[model samples]
Target: MEKYIDIIKNSYSGYWNYLKNEIFFQNHWDNYFYGLIIISLLVWGLEILFPWRKNQSIFRKDFWLDTFYMFFNFFLLNLIILIALSNTAAEFLNDILSSVGLSLQSLQIFDVDNLPNWLGLFVFFIVSDFVQWNTHRLLHRVPFLWNFHKVHHSVKEMGFAAHLRYHWMEPVVYKSLLYLPIAIIGNYDAKDVAIVYFFTITIGHLNHANLGWDYGLFKYIVNNPKMHIWHHAKALPKHVRFGVNYGLTLSIWDYIFKTNYIPHNGKDIELGFSGDETFPKDFIKQELYPILSKNKDFD
Candidate 1:
Protein backbone atom coordinates (compact mmCIF):
# COMPACT_ATOMS: atom_id res chain seq x y z
CA MET A 1 0.00 0.00 0.00
CA GLU A 2 2.82 2.39 0.86
CA LYS A 3 4.55 1.47 -2.42
CA TYR A 4 1.41 2.29 -4.33
CA ILE A 5 1.06 5.58 -2.53
CA ASP A 6 4.68 6.45 -3.34
CA ILE A 7 4.10 5.62 -6.99
CA ILE A 8 1.07 7.89 -7.11
CA LYS A 9 2.97 10.71 -5.45
CA ASN A 10 5.87 10.30 -7.87
CA SER A 11 3.43 10.33 -10.77
CA TYR A 12 1.96 13.61 -9.61
CA SER A 13 5.37 15.22 -9.22
CA GLY A 14 6.52 13.86 -12.60
CA TYR A 15 3.37 15.09 -14.27
CA TRP A 16 3.79 18.54 -12.76
CA ASN A 17 7.42 18.78 -13.87
CA TYR A 18 6.55 17.54 -17.34
CA LEU A 19 3.75 20.05 -17.67
CA LYS A 20 6.03 22.86 -16.58
CA ASN A 21 8.77 21.94 -19.02
CA GLU A 22 6.29 21.73 -21.90
CA ILE A 23 4.73 25.07 -21.04
CA PHE A 24 8.06 26.82 -20.49
CA PHE A 25 9.65 25.39 -23.64
CA GLN A 26 12.50 23.68 -21.79
CA ASN A 27 14.41 21.20 -23.97
CA HIS A 28 12.69 22.87 -26.89
CA TRP A 29 14.31 20.66 -29.49
CA ASP A 30 13.06 17.47 -27.85
CA ASN A 31 9.81 18.89 -26.55
CA TYR A 32 6.80 17.19 -28.13
CA PHE A 33 4.67 20.27 -27.45
CA TYR A 34 6.88 22.36 -29.72
CA GLY A 35 7.30 19.49 -32.14
CA LEU A 36 3.55 19.09 -32.56
CA ILE A 37 3.03 22.80 -33.14
CA ILE A 38 5.87 23.08 -35.65
CA ILE A 39 4.77 20.00 -37.56
CA SER A 40 1.12 21.06 -37.57
CA LEU A 41 2.01 24.53 -38.85
CA LEU A 42 4.22 23.10 -41.58
CA VAL A 43 1.53 20.65 -42.70
CA TRP A 44 -1.20 23.27 -42.47
CA GLY A 45 0.83 25.54 -44.72
CA LEU A 46 1.18 22.75 -47.26
CA GLU A 47 -2.53 22.02 -47.08
CA ILE A 48 -3.33 25.67 -47.70
CA LEU A 49 -0.94 25.78 -50.66
CA PHE A 50 -1.85 22.46 -52.26
CA PRO A 51 -5.16 21.19 -51.01
CA TRP A 52 -6.47 18.12 -52.80
CA ARG A 53 -10.00 19.02 -51.86
CA LYS A 54 -10.23 22.56 -53.15
CA ASN A 55 -13.66 23.26 -51.70
CA GLN A 56 -12.54 22.30 -48.21
CA SER A 57 -12.27 25.49 -46.15
CA ILE A 58 -9.08 26.52 -44.38
CA PHE A 59 -11.02 26.55 -41.13
CA ARG A 60 -12.73 23.29 -41.94
CA LYS A 61 -15.67 21.95 -40.00
CA ASP A 62 -14.72 20.61 -36.56
CA PHE A 63 -11.19 21.95 -37.00
CA TRP A 64 -11.06 23.42 -33.50
CA LEU A 65 -12.51 20.24 -32.06
CA ASP A 66 -9.77 18.18 -33.63
CA THR A 67 -7.17 20.70 -32.49
CA PHE A 68 -8.38 20.31 -28.93
CA TYR A 69 -8.12 16.55 -29.33
CA MET A 70 -4.54 16.94 -30.48
CA PHE A 71 -3.45 18.65 -27.26
CA PHE A 72 -5.68 16.50 -25.08
CA ASN A 73 -4.51 13.18 -26.47
CA PHE A 74 -0.88 14.15 -26.99
CA PHE A 75 -0.34 15.98 -23.70
CA LEU A 76 -3.06 15.96 -21.08
CA LEU A 77 -4.22 12.34 -21.21
CA ASN A 78 -0.86 10.94 -22.33
CA LEU A 79 1.31 12.84 -19.88
CA ILE A 80 -0.96 12.91 -16.85
CA ILE A 81 -2.95 9.69 -17.12
CA LEU A 82 -0.91 7.23 -19.19
CA ILE A 83 2.47 8.06 -17.69
CA ALA A 84 1.22 7.52 -14.16
CA LEU A 85 -0.69 4.34 -14.93
CA SER A 86 2.13 2.88 -17.04
CA ASN A 87 4.73 3.66 -14.37
CA THR A 88 2.64 2.02 -11.65
CA ALA A 89 1.98 -1.00 -13.82
CA ALA A 90 5.66 -1.31 -14.68
CA GLU A 91 6.64 -1.19 -11.00
CA PHE A 92 4.03 -3.79 -10.10
CA LEU A 93 5.16 -6.08 -12.91
CA ASN A 94 8.77 -5.65 -11.84
CA ASP A 95 7.90 -6.63 -8.27
CA ILE A 96 6.09 -9.76 -9.42
CA LEU A 97 8.95 -10.75 -11.73
CA SER A 98 11.54 -10.14 -9.00
CA SER A 99 9.67 -12.47 -6.70
CA VAL A 100 9.92 -15.19 -9.38
CA GLY A 101 13.67 -14.57 -9.90
CA LEU A 102 13.08 -13.05 -13.41
CA SER A 103 13.70 -9.59 -14.77
CA LEU A 104 13.08 -7.73 -18.03
CA GLN A 105 16.75 -8.10 -18.97
CA SER A 106 16.38 -11.87 -18.87
CA LEU A 107 13.47 -11.67 -21.29
CA GLN A 108 15.30 -9.73 -24.02
CA ILE A 109 15.22 -11.46 -27.41
CA PHE A 110 18.48 -9.68 -28.35
CA ASP A 111 20.80 -7.24 -26.63
CA VAL A 112 19.89 -4.00 -28.35
CA ASP A 113 22.52 -2.22 -26.22
CA ASN A 114 25.33 -3.91 -28.16
CA LEU A 115 23.97 -2.76 -31.53
CA PRO A 116 24.81 0.59 -33.07
CA ASN A 117 22.44 3.40 -32.12
CA TRP A 118 21.22 3.76 -35.69
CA LEU A 119 20.56 0.03 -36.04
CA GLY A 120 18.82 -0.09 -32.68
CA LEU A 121 16.57 2.79 -33.66
CA PHE A 122 15.90 1.20 -37.04
CA VAL A 123 14.92 -2.14 -35.52
CA PHE A 124 12.80 -0.47 -32.85
CA PHE A 125 11.06 1.71 -35.48
CA ILE A 126 10.18 -1.22 -37.74
CA VAL A 127 8.98 -3.46 -34.92
CA SER A 128 6.98 -0.70 -33.24
CA ASP A 129 5.29 0.27 -36.52
CA PHE A 130 4.34 -3.36 -37.16
CA VAL A 131 2.90 -3.63 -33.64
CA GLN A 132 0.86 -0.47 -34.24
CA TRP A 133 -0.36 -1.78 -37.62
CA ASN A 134 -1.71 -4.90 -35.97
CA THR A 135 -3.24 -2.87 -33.12
CA HIS A 136 -4.98 -0.63 -35.69
CA ARG A 137 -6.48 -3.66 -37.46
CA LEU A 138 -7.78 -4.94 -34.13
CA LEU A 139 -9.36 -1.58 -33.41
CA HIS A 140 -11.39 -1.93 -36.59
CA ARG A 141 -12.12 -5.66 -36.50
CA VAL A 142 -13.23 -5.75 -32.85
CA PRO A 143 -16.56 -4.08 -32.17
CA PHE A 144 -15.62 -2.95 -28.64
CA LEU A 145 -12.36 -1.36 -29.78
CA TRP A 146 -14.08 0.11 -32.81
CA ASN A 147 -16.36 2.04 -30.46
CA PHE A 148 -13.34 4.00 -29.21
CA HIS A 149 -11.70 4.23 -32.64
CA LYS A 150 -14.91 5.83 -33.94
CA VAL A 151 -13.80 9.15 -32.44
CA HIS A 152 -11.04 9.34 -35.04
CA HIS A 153 -13.16 8.23 -38.02
CA SER A 154 -15.75 10.81 -37.11
CA VAL A 155 -13.69 13.32 -39.05
CA LYS A 156 -15.76 14.85 -41.85
CA GLU A 157 -13.10 17.26 -43.12
CA MET A 158 -9.57 15.96 -42.97
CA GLY A 159 -6.76 18.30 -41.95
CA PHE A 160 -3.35 18.27 -40.27
CA ALA A 161 -4.68 18.38 -36.70
CA ALA A 162 -7.05 15.55 -37.57
CA HIS A 163 -4.08 13.25 -37.15
CA LEU A 164 -4.34 13.31 -33.35
CA ARG A 165 -8.14 13.42 -33.19
CA TYR A 166 -8.63 10.13 -31.39
CA HIS A 167 -10.25 8.86 -28.21
CA TRP A 168 -8.00 9.05 -25.11
CA MET A 169 -8.43 5.31 -24.61
CA GLU A 170 -6.39 4.76 -27.79
CA PRO A 171 -3.09 5.53 -26.05
CA VAL A 172 -4.06 3.19 -23.24
CA VAL A 173 -4.58 0.41 -25.78
CA TYR A 174 -1.54 1.30 -27.90
CA LYS A 175 0.94 1.74 -25.05
CA SER A 176 -0.27 -1.39 -23.26
CA LEU A 177 0.45 -3.45 -26.38
CA LEU A 178 3.63 -1.58 -27.31
CA TYR A 179 5.18 -1.84 -23.84
CA LEU A 180 6.41 -5.44 -23.90
CA PRO A 181 7.86 -5.36 -27.42
CA ILE A 182 9.65 -2.11 -26.68
CA ALA A 183 10.86 -3.36 -23.29
CA ILE A 184 12.39 -6.45 -24.89
CA ILE A 185 14.51 -4.17 -27.07
CA GLY A 186 16.33 -2.80 -23.99
CA ASN A 187 16.01 0.71 -22.62
CA TYR A 188 17.21 3.77 -24.55
CA ASP A 189 16.71 7.48 -24.14
CA ALA A 190 13.75 8.76 -26.13
CA LYS A 191 15.91 11.78 -27.08
CA ASP A 192 18.19 9.45 -29.06
CA VAL A 193 15.32 8.49 -31.39
CA ALA A 194 13.44 11.78 -31.51
CA ILE A 195 13.96 11.92 -35.27
CA VAL A 196 11.96 8.74 -35.86
CA TYR A 197 9.20 9.97 -33.57
CA PHE A 198 9.04 13.32 -35.40
CA PHE A 199 9.13 11.59 -38.77
CA THR A 200 6.10 9.46 -37.88
CA ILE A 201 4.28 12.51 -36.54
CA THR A 202 4.92 14.34 -39.83
CA ILE A 203 3.73 11.38 -41.89
CA GLY A 204 0.64 11.02 -39.70
CA HIS A 205 -0.20 14.70 -40.11
CA LEU A 206 0.33 14.50 -43.86
CA ASN A 207 -1.79 11.37 -44.08
CA HIS A 208 -4.73 13.22 -42.54
CA ALA A 209 -4.10 16.55 -44.26
CA ASN A 210 -6.05 17.68 -47.32
CA LEU A 211 -2.99 17.01 -49.44
CA GLY A 212 -2.60 14.58 -52.33
CA TRP A 213 0.79 12.94 -52.10
CA ASP A 214 1.74 9.32 -52.69
CA TYR A 215 5.53 9.61 -52.26
CA GLY A 216 5.47 8.40 -55.91
CA LEU A 217 7.88 5.45 -56.19
CA PHE A 218 8.11 5.22 -52.40
CA LYS A 219 4.33 4.85 -52.08
CA TYR A 220 4.84 1.26 -50.99
CA ILE A 221 7.50 2.25 -48.46
CA VAL A 222 5.91 5.07 -46.53
CA ASN A 223 2.28 5.92 -45.90
CA ASN A 224 1.14 9.11 -47.64
CA PRO A 225 -1.98 11.22 -47.97
CA LYS A 226 -3.25 9.62 -51.21
CA MET A 227 -3.04 6.08 -49.85
CA HIS A 228 -4.32 6.91 -46.37
CA ILE A 229 -7.37 8.87 -47.52
CA TRP A 230 -8.80 5.59 -48.74
CA HIS A 231 -8.42 4.19 -45.24
CA HIS A 232 -11.12 6.57 -44.05
CA ALA A 233 -13.52 5.94 -46.95
CA LYS A 234 -17.08 5.60 -45.72
CA ALA A 235 -17.77 2.51 -47.81
CA LEU A 236 -15.52 -0.49 -47.35
CA PRO A 237 -14.50 -2.57 -50.34
CA LYS A 238 -16.80 -5.43 -51.35
CA HIS A 239 -14.46 -8.09 -50.01
CA VAL A 240 -12.70 -6.10 -47.29
CA ARG A 241 -15.09 -5.86 -44.37
CA PHE A 242 -13.01 -4.70 -41.37
CA GLY A 243 -10.70 -2.01 -42.75
CA VAL A 244 -7.75 -1.25 -45.06
CA ASN A 245 -4.48 0.69 -44.91
CA TYR A 246 -4.02 -0.09 -41.23
CA GLY A 247 -0.45 1.13 -41.44
CA LEU A 248 0.43 3.88 -38.96
CA THR A 249 3.89 5.00 -40.12
CA LEU A 250 4.92 2.69 -42.95
CA SER A 251 2.81 1.42 -45.88
CA ILE A 252 5.10 -1.60 -46.23
CA TRP A 253 3.05 -3.58 -43.72
CA ASP A 254 -0.13 -3.08 -45.72
CA TYR A 255 1.58 -4.17 -48.94
CA ILE A 256 3.22 -7.14 -47.25
CA PHE A 257 -0.08 -8.30 -45.75
CA LYS A 258 -2.12 -7.65 -48.96
CA THR A 259 -4.32 -5.11 -47.14
CA ASN A 260 -3.30 -2.13 -49.26
CA TYR A 261 -6.40 -0.92 -51.13
CA ILE A 262 -6.29 2.15 -53.30
CA PRO A 263 -8.82 1.53 -56.04
CA HIS A 264 -8.79 5.14 -57.20
CA ASN A 265 -7.29 8.54 -56.42
CA GLY A 266 -9.64 8.78 -53.37
CA LYS A 267 -9.41 12.56 -53.48
CA ASP A 268 -13.17 13.03 -53.10
CA ILE A 269 -14.30 9.89 -51.27
CA GLU A 270 -16.88 10.27 -48.54
CA LEU A 271 -15.50 9.96 -45.00
CA GLY A 272 -17.02 8.58 -41.72
CA PHE A 273 -19.09 5.51 -40.94
CA SER A 274 -22.77 4.86 -41.82
CA GLY A 275 -24.28 6.06 -38.54
CA ASP A 276 -21.77 8.87 -37.98
CA GLU A 277 -24.50 11.47 -38.23
CA THR A 278 -25.83 10.19 -34.91
CA PHE A 279 -22.42 9.95 -33.20
CA PRO A 280 -21.85 12.42 -30.44
CA LYS A 281 -20.56 15.79 -31.69
CA ASP A 282 -19.63 17.26 -28.33
CA PHE A 283 -16.21 16.14 -27.10
CA ILE A 284 -17.44 15.12 -23.63
CA LYS A 285 -20.30 13.11 -25.12
CA GLN A 286 -18.02 11.52 -27.70
CA GLU A 287 -15.60 10.42 -24.98
CA LEU A 288 -18.36 8.88 -22.89
CA TYR A 289 -20.55 7.47 -25.70
CA PRO A 290 -18.41 4.38 -26.27
CA ILE A 291 -18.72 3.40 -22.59
CA LEU A 292 -22.28 4.50 -21.88
CA SER A 293 -24.20 3.98 -25.11
CA LYS A 294 -25.77 0.61 -25.96
CA ASN A 295 -24.85 0.86 -29.65
CA LYS A 296 -22.74 -2.25 -30.23
CA ASP A 297 -23.33 -2.39 -33.99
CA PHE A 298 -20.14 -0.47 -34.80
CA ASP A 299 -19.88 -2.52 -37.98
Candidate 2:
Protein backbone atom coordinates (compact mmCIF):
# COMPACT_ATOMS: atom_id res chain seq x y z
CA MET A 1 0.00 0.00 0.00
CA GLU A 2 2.88 2.34 0.66
CA LYS A 3 4.33 1.66 -2.77
CA TYR A 4 0.94 2.26 -4.40
CA ILE A 5 0.53 5.56 -2.63
CA ASP A 6 4.03 6.58 -3.65
CA ILE A 7 3.24 5.78 -7.29
CA ILE A 8 0.11 7.91 -7.19
CA LYS A 9 2.04 10.73 -5.56
CA ASN A 10 4.73 10.49 -8.21
CA SER A 11 2.04 10.69 -10.89
CA TYR A 12 0.74 14.01 -9.68
CA SER A 13 4.27 15.32 -9.19
CA GLY A 14 5.37 14.21 -12.65
CA TYR A 15 2.42 15.91 -14.35
CA TRP A 16 2.94 19.05 -12.30
CA ASN A 17 6.63 19.14 -13.18
CA TYR A 18 5.83 19.42 -16.83
CA LEU A 19 3.01 21.78 -16.10
CA LYS A 20 5.35 24.14 -14.24
CA ASN A 21 8.10 24.13 -16.87
CA GLU A 22 6.26 27.04 -18.52
CA ILE A 23 7.71 29.27 -15.80
CA PHE A 24 10.99 29.07 -17.64
CA PHE A 25 9.53 29.76 -21.07
CA GLN A 26 8.89 33.34 -22.18
CA ASN A 27 5.20 33.05 -23.11
CA HIS A 28 2.34 32.98 -20.66
CA TRP A 29 1.16 29.80 -22.41
CA ASP A 30 1.84 26.51 -20.69
CA ASN A 31 2.74 24.16 -23.51
CA TYR A 32 1.41 20.87 -22.14
CA PHE A 33 -1.70 22.11 -20.40
CA TYR A 34 -2.50 24.65 -23.10
CA GLY A 35 -2.37 22.00 -25.78
CA LEU A 36 -4.46 19.66 -23.69
CA ILE A 37 -7.17 22.25 -23.04
CA ILE A 38 -7.23 23.58 -26.59
CA ILE A 39 -7.21 20.28 -28.47
CA SER A 40 -9.73 18.70 -26.12
CA LEU A 41 -12.16 21.58 -26.43
CA LEU A 42 -11.71 21.62 -30.19
CA VAL A 43 -12.25 17.90 -30.62
CA TRP A 44 -15.16 17.90 -28.21
CA GLY A 45 -16.69 20.77 -30.10
CA LEU A 46 -16.25 19.06 -33.43
CA GLU A 47 -17.73 15.81 -32.13
CA ILE A 48 -20.73 17.74 -30.87
CA LEU A 49 -21.14 19.70 -34.09
CA PHE A 50 -21.03 16.76 -36.45
CA PRO A 51 -21.33 13.44 -34.74
CA TRP A 52 -21.38 10.44 -37.04
CA ARG A 53 -23.47 8.41 -34.65
CA LYS A 54 -26.09 11.05 -33.98
CA ASN A 55 -27.98 8.91 -31.50
CA GLN A 56 -24.95 7.98 -29.41
CA SER A 57 -25.05 9.73 -26.04
CA ILE A 58 -22.40 12.28 -25.13
CA PHE A 59 -21.85 10.28 -21.97
CA ARG A 60 -22.00 6.94 -23.67
CA LYS A 61 -20.97 3.71 -22.02
CA ASP A 62 -17.44 3.99 -20.63
CA PHE A 63 -17.36 7.70 -21.41
CA TRP A 64 -16.10 8.54 -17.97
CA LEU A 65 -13.88 5.45 -18.01
CA ASP A 66 -12.09 6.72 -21.10
CA THR A 67 -11.94 10.09 -19.38
CA PHE A 68 -10.29 8.40 -16.43
CA TYR A 69 -7.88 6.74 -18.85
CA MET A 70 -6.91 10.06 -20.41
CA PHE A 71 -5.95 11.57 -17.05
CA PHE A 72 -4.42 8.28 -15.96
CA ASN A 73 -2.26 8.29 -19.07
CA PHE A 74 -1.39 11.96 -18.63
CA PHE A 75 -0.40 11.49 -15.03
CA LEU A 76 0.05 8.04 -13.49
CA LEU A 77 1.16 5.99 -16.47
CA ASN A 78 3.39 8.75 -17.74
CA LEU A 79 4.91 9.14 -14.27
CA ILE A 80 5.58 5.42 -14.13
CA ILE A 81 7.26 5.53 -17.48
CA LEU A 82 9.48 8.38 -16.38
CA ILE A 83 10.29 7.26 -12.86
CA ALA A 84 10.22 3.46 -12.99
CA LEU A 85 11.18 2.87 -16.61
CA SER A 86 12.67 5.67 -18.74
CA ASN A 87 14.98 7.33 -16.23
CA THR A 88 16.34 4.03 -14.96
CA ALA A 89 16.95 2.79 -18.48
CA ALA A 90 18.64 6.02 -19.39
CA GLU A 91 20.95 5.91 -16.40
CA PHE A 92 21.83 2.24 -16.89
CA LEU A 93 22.27 2.60 -20.64
CA ASN A 94 24.43 5.69 -20.21
CA ASP A 95 26.59 3.87 -17.70
CA ILE A 96 27.06 0.97 -20.08
CA LEU A 97 27.80 3.25 -22.99
CA SER A 98 30.31 5.27 -20.97
CA SER A 99 31.98 2.08 -19.82
CA VAL A 100 32.37 1.16 -23.46
CA GLY A 101 33.66 4.73 -24.26
CA LEU A 102 30.69 5.59 -26.45
CA SER A 103 28.44 8.63 -26.37
CA LEU A 104 25.21 9.33 -28.25
CA GLN A 105 26.59 12.67 -29.51
CA SER A 106 29.65 10.96 -30.95
CA LEU A 107 27.51 8.20 -32.46
CA GLN A 108 25.25 10.56 -34.39
CA ILE A 109 24.12 9.15 -37.72
CA PHE A 110 23.08 12.54 -39.21
CA ASP A 111 23.18 16.13 -38.05
CA VAL A 112 19.37 16.36 -37.86
CA ASP A 113 19.41 19.56 -35.82
CA ASN A 114 21.31 21.49 -38.46
CA LEU A 115 18.65 20.93 -41.06
CA PRO A 116 15.99 23.55 -41.79
CA ASN A 117 13.29 23.51 -39.11
CA TRP A 118 10.55 22.60 -41.56
CA LEU A 119 12.55 19.78 -43.15
CA GLY A 120 13.84 18.53 -39.82
CA LEU A 121 10.34 18.39 -38.43
CA PHE A 122 9.15 16.72 -41.62
CA VAL A 123 11.75 13.96 -41.50
CA PHE A 124 11.16 13.32 -37.82
CA PHE A 125 7.44 13.25 -38.45
CA ILE A 126 7.77 10.59 -41.14
CA VAL A 127 10.20 8.52 -39.10
CA SER A 128 8.03 8.74 -36.00
CA ASP A 129 4.91 8.03 -38.03
CA PHE A 130 6.43 4.96 -39.62
CA VAL A 131 7.64 3.80 -36.24
CA GLN A 132 4.16 4.34 -34.82
CA TRP A 133 2.64 2.59 -37.83
CA ASN A 134 4.77 -0.46 -37.25
CA THR A 135 4.18 -0.28 -33.51
CA HIS A 136 0.43 -0.15 -34.11
CA ARG A 137 0.70 -3.16 -36.42
CA LEU A 138 2.84 -5.16 -34.00
CA LEU A 139 0.30 -4.48 -31.29
CA HIS A 140 -2.30 -6.18 -33.44
CA ARG A 141 -0.21 -8.97 -34.98
CA VAL A 142 1.77 -10.21 -31.97
CA PRO A 143 -0.40 -12.32 -29.71
CA PHE A 144 0.98 -11.43 -26.28
CA LEU A 145 1.37 -7.82 -27.31
CA TRP A 146 -2.23 -7.78 -28.49
CA ASN A 147 -3.38 -8.71 -25.01
CA PHE A 148 -2.10 -5.36 -23.71
CA HIS A 149 -3.08 -3.49 -26.86
CA LYS A 150 -6.66 -4.72 -26.50
CA VAL A 151 -7.38 -2.01 -23.92
CA HIS A 152 -7.57 0.59 -26.65
CA HIS A 153 -9.76 -1.57 -28.85
CA SER A 154 -12.22 -2.38 -26.07
CA VAL A 155 -13.86 0.99 -26.53
CA LYS A 156 -17.41 0.71 -27.87
CA GLU A 157 -17.90 4.44 -28.19
CA MET A 158 -15.25 6.47 -30.01
CA GLY A 159 -14.25 9.94 -28.85
CA PHE A 160 -11.27 12.21 -28.16
CA ALA A 161 -10.47 10.49 -24.87
CA ALA A 162 -10.11 7.21 -26.70
CA HIS A 163 -6.96 8.59 -28.31
CA LEU A 164 -4.93 8.52 -25.06
CA ARG A 165 -6.53 5.29 -23.86
CA TYR A 166 -3.81 2.68 -23.73
CA HIS A 167 -2.41 -0.03 -21.51
CA TRP A 168 0.27 1.09 -19.08
CA MET A 169 3.01 -0.91 -20.76
CA GLU A 170 2.52 0.64 -24.19
CA PRO A 171 4.85 3.61 -23.58
CA VAL A 172 7.57 1.21 -22.50
CA VAL A 173 7.59 -0.62 -25.81
CA TYR A 174 7.03 2.49 -27.89
CA LYS A 175 9.43 4.86 -26.11
CA SER A 176 12.13 2.25 -25.54
CA LEU A 177 12.12 1.10 -29.15
CA LEU A 178 11.83 4.65 -30.42
CA TYR A 179 14.94 5.61 -28.43
CA LEU A 180 17.19 3.66 -30.78
CA PRO A 181 16.37 5.48 -34.02
CA ILE A 182 15.84 8.98 -32.63
CA ALA A 183 19.08 8.73 -30.70
CA ILE A 184 20.97 8.29 -33.94
CA ILE A 185 19.30 11.30 -35.54
CA GLY A 186 20.45 13.37 -32.56
CA ASN A 187 19.40 16.91 -33.47
CA TYR A 188 16.05 17.72 -31.95
CA ASP A 189 15.67 21.24 -30.59
CA ALA A 190 12.73 22.27 -28.43
CA LYS A 191 10.89 23.76 -31.41
CA ASP A 192 11.22 20.57 -33.45
CA VAL A 193 9.82 18.45 -30.65
CA ALA A 194 6.93 20.87 -30.16
CA ILE A 195 6.14 20.91 -33.88
CA VAL A 196 6.02 17.15 -34.10
CA TYR A 197 3.78 16.92 -31.04
CA PHE A 198 1.46 19.60 -32.42
CA PHE A 199 0.43 17.42 -35.32
CA THR A 200 0.46 14.20 -33.32
CA ILE A 201 -1.86 15.46 -30.59
CA THR A 202 -4.23 17.29 -32.88
CA ILE A 203 -4.37 14.98 -35.90
CA GLY A 204 -4.37 11.92 -33.69
CA HIS A 205 -7.45 12.97 -31.74
CA LEU A 206 -9.29 13.96 -34.92
CA ASN A 207 -8.70 10.55 -36.45
CA HIS A 208 -10.30 8.65 -33.56
CA ALA A 209 -13.17 11.14 -33.29
CA ASN A 210 -16.75 10.25 -34.22
CA LEU A 211 -16.60 12.40 -37.33
CA GLY A 212 -16.93 11.05 -40.85
CA TRP A 213 -15.80 11.88 -44.40
CA ASP A 214 -12.56 10.86 -46.03
CA TYR A 215 -10.29 13.84 -46.65
CA GLY A 216 -11.26 13.86 -50.34
CA LEU A 217 -8.17 14.52 -52.47
CA PHE A 218 -5.84 14.19 -49.50
CA LYS A 219 -7.28 10.88 -48.31
CA TYR A 220 -4.50 8.82 -49.93
CA ILE A 221 -1.75 10.89 -48.33
CA VAL A 222 -3.06 11.91 -44.93
CA ASN A 223 -5.09 9.62 -42.69
CA ASN A 224 -8.67 10.76 -42.13
CA PRO A 225 -11.55 9.95 -39.82
CA LYS A 226 -13.26 7.79 -42.43
CA MET A 227 -10.23 5.57 -43.12
CA HIS A 228 -9.46 5.16 -39.43
CA ILE A 229 -13.03 4.34 -38.49
CA TRP A 230 -12.71 1.14 -40.48
CA HIS A 231 -9.56 0.23 -38.60
CA HIS A 232 -11.78 -0.27 -35.55
CA ALA A 233 -14.26 -2.29 -37.60
CA LYS A 234 -15.64 -5.28 -35.68
CA ALA A 235 -14.50 -7.75 -38.31
CA LEU A 236 -11.40 -7.19 -40.34
CA PRO A 237 -12.02 -5.80 -43.79
CA LYS A 238 -12.10 -8.47 -46.52
CA HIS A 239 -8.77 -8.82 -48.41
CA VAL A 240 -6.88 -6.89 -45.76
CA ARG A 241 -3.94 -9.24 -45.59
CA PHE A 242 -2.23 -8.40 -42.27
CA GLY A 243 -3.81 -5.79 -40.01
CA VAL A 244 -4.83 -3.15 -42.50
CA ASN A 245 -4.23 0.63 -42.28
CA TYR A 246 -1.76 0.67 -39.44
CA GLY A 247 -0.53 4.10 -40.46
CA LEU A 248 -0.96 6.72 -37.74
CA THR A 249 -0.59 10.00 -39.64
CA LEU A 250 0.12 9.25 -43.27
CA SER A 251 -1.91 6.68 -45.20
CA ILE A 252 0.84 6.34 -47.79
CA TRP A 253 2.52 3.57 -45.87
CA ASP A 254 -0.66 1.54 -45.90
CA TYR A 255 -1.11 2.33 -49.55
CA ILE A 256 2.39 1.15 -50.41
CA PHE A 257 1.93 -2.00 -48.38
CA LYS A 258 -1.52 -2.57 -49.90
CA THR A 259 -3.19 -2.52 -46.52
CA ASN A 260 -5.39 0.47 -47.30
CA TYR A 261 -9.15 -0.04 -47.05
CA ILE A 262 -11.70 2.74 -47.06
CA PRO A 263 -15.20 1.99 -48.25
CA HIS A 264 -17.45 4.71 -49.62
CA ASN A 265 -18.85 5.35 -46.13
CA GLY A 266 -18.42 4.23 -42.51
CA LYS A 267 -22.09 4.41 -41.57
CA ASP A 268 -22.58 0.74 -40.78
CA ILE A 269 -19.38 0.36 -38.81
CA GLU A 270 -19.52 -1.07 -35.27
CA LEU A 271 -16.64 -0.29 -32.96
CA GLY A 272 -14.63 -2.51 -30.58
CA PHE A 273 -13.41 -6.10 -30.90
CA SER A 274 -15.73 -8.67 -32.34
CA GLY A 275 -17.58 -10.60 -29.59
CA ASP A 276 -15.66 -8.93 -26.74
CA GLU A 277 -18.35 -9.07 -24.08
CA THR A 278 -16.09 -10.70 -21.50
CA PHE A 279 -13.76 -7.71 -21.56
CA PRO A 280 -13.77 -5.71 -18.36
CA LYS A 281 -16.22 -2.81 -18.17
CA ASP A 282 -14.35 -0.79 -15.55
CA PHE A 283 -11.04 1.12 -15.68
CA ILE A 284 -9.18 -0.65 -12.88
CA LYS A 285 -10.18 -4.06 -14.21
CA GLN A 286 -9.29 -3.08 -17.75
CA GLU A 287 -5.84 -2.10 -16.53
CA LEU A 288 -5.48 -5.52 -14.93
CA TYR A 289 -7.40 -7.48 -17.56
CA PRO A 290 -4.51 -7.91 -19.96
CA ILE A 291 -2.15 -9.42 -17.41
CA LEU A 292 -4.82 -11.64 -15.83
CA SER A 293 -5.57 -13.34 -19.12
CA LYS A 294 -2.72 -15.35 -20.59
CA ASN A 295 -4.41 -16.19 -23.89
CA LYS A 296 -2.12 -15.51 -26.83
CA ASP A 297 -4.90 -14.89 -29.27
CA PHE A 298 -6.81 -11.60 -28.96
CA ASP A 299 -9.96 -13.57 -28.13
User: Who wins the TM-score comparison?
Assistant: 1
Q: Tens digits of per-residue lDDT for model 1 on 1-299? A: 79987987888788879888888958758888888899999999999999899999999999999999988988888566887788988888888889999998888888666789889889989989999999999999888899899999999889999999999888889988998898888876678778888999999999999999998899999999999988899998668868899999899999999999999889989999868989999899999988996655643
Predict model 2's lDDT versus the native: 0.76
Model 2: how far residue 102 lies from native, Å? 2.7
Lowest lDDT block of 10, candidate 1: 290-299
Give the per-residue lDDT of model 2 (tens digit) for 1-299.
46555655665676557646643543644376566658878998898999988987777677788878877786556555555566556656766789999987777788678888788888778888888888888888788888888888887778878888889878778888787677778758865587678678777788888788577898898888888887877777545533567878888999998888876577667777754778888878888987788753543
Clashing pairs in 2: none
lDDT of every model, 2 decimals: 0.89, 0.76
Clashing pairs in 1: none
RMSD to truth, every model: 1.3, 4.1
Model 1 regions lying over 4 Å from their true place? 25-27
For residue 176, model 1's alpha carbon misses the true position, in angstroms, by 0.5
